[model samples]
Target: MAKYSEKASKKVEQAIHTEKEGKLRTGTGKKVTSRKQAIAIGLSEARKEGAKVPQKKD
Candidate 1:
């Protein structure tokens, strides 16, 4: 199992809350309507922040 850092987890939580409150928007100015997409965005942000997130394994 891969482990995500505290910061990454926090970002994911924030994204979830933002999505639930209809406060999340994409870069193209479109509203985010999916929880999974919000989570992906959060993880991407966490990666940009240098969090210890592992790459997806397939």
Candidate 2:
């Protein structure tokens, strides 16, 4: 796997944790149902925070 910044990893961890707790949600306020979705949400948040995440694919 590609190396991620510490902050980026932390964000993903937090998101996974929240998902496991059944507290993760989407923009439409729908409950999160997939691991990939959670990670994507985490990376999106990290990007918004200007963390050292890799650029998203087009």
Candidate 3:
């Protein structure tokens, strides 16, 4: 597995907390109703910013 940077981890952590509190929202205004979705969003953002390596699908 590839390692995520501290910044990336922090974003994901915040998203997880927000998801747990039912306050997570995506950039397009959609609510993050699932933990997995929130984490995916964070990871995608990190990838976009070049803060973390993206996972390759098998």
Candidate 4:
């Protein structure tokens, strides 16, 4: 199990909320329908903000 920082967790939660509200979109401007995709988006944002997120898996 990979460890995520508090900031990362919060970001993920916020993303899920946005997804549930149909406000989350992908880079291509398409709606995100998958929970996993929402989680990925959250982690990506967290990484950009310098949160202590684990390295992306290959």
- The model with the greatest lDDT is 4
Poorly placed runs, candidate 4 (over 4 Å): none
Task: For model 2, state the Cα shift of residue 27 in Å.
Answer: 0.7
Top candidate (TM-score): 4
TM-score, one value per model: 0.89, 0.92, 0.69, 0.96
After TM-score superposition, the amount by which residue 11's alpha carbon in candidate 2 deviates from its true location, in angstroms, is: 0.3
Please tell me which model should have the higher TM-score, number 1 or number 2.
Answer: 2
**Candidate 2 residue-wise lDDT at 37:** 96
Please give, for residues 1-58, the per-residue lDDT of candidate 4 as tens digits.
Answer: 8899999999999999999999999999999999999999999999999999999989
Worst 10 residues of 1 by lDDT: 49-58
1-58 in candidate 1: lDDT tens per residue? 7899999999999999998999898889889999998998899899999999998556
Q: Which ten-residue region of model 4 has the weakest summed lDDT?
A: 1-10
Q: How displaced is residue 10 in candidate 1, in Å? A: 0.1
Per residue, candidate 3 scores C-alpha lDDT tens digits across 1-58 of 6787988998888779888898888889978888889888778777778785557457
Taking the candidates one at a time, how many backbone clashes does each contain? 0, 0, 0, 0
After superposition on all CA atoms, how large is the RMSD of candidate 3?
2.3
Give the higher-lDDT candidate: 1 or 3.
1
Which segments of model 2 are wrong by more than 4 Å?
none
TM-score of 4: 0.96
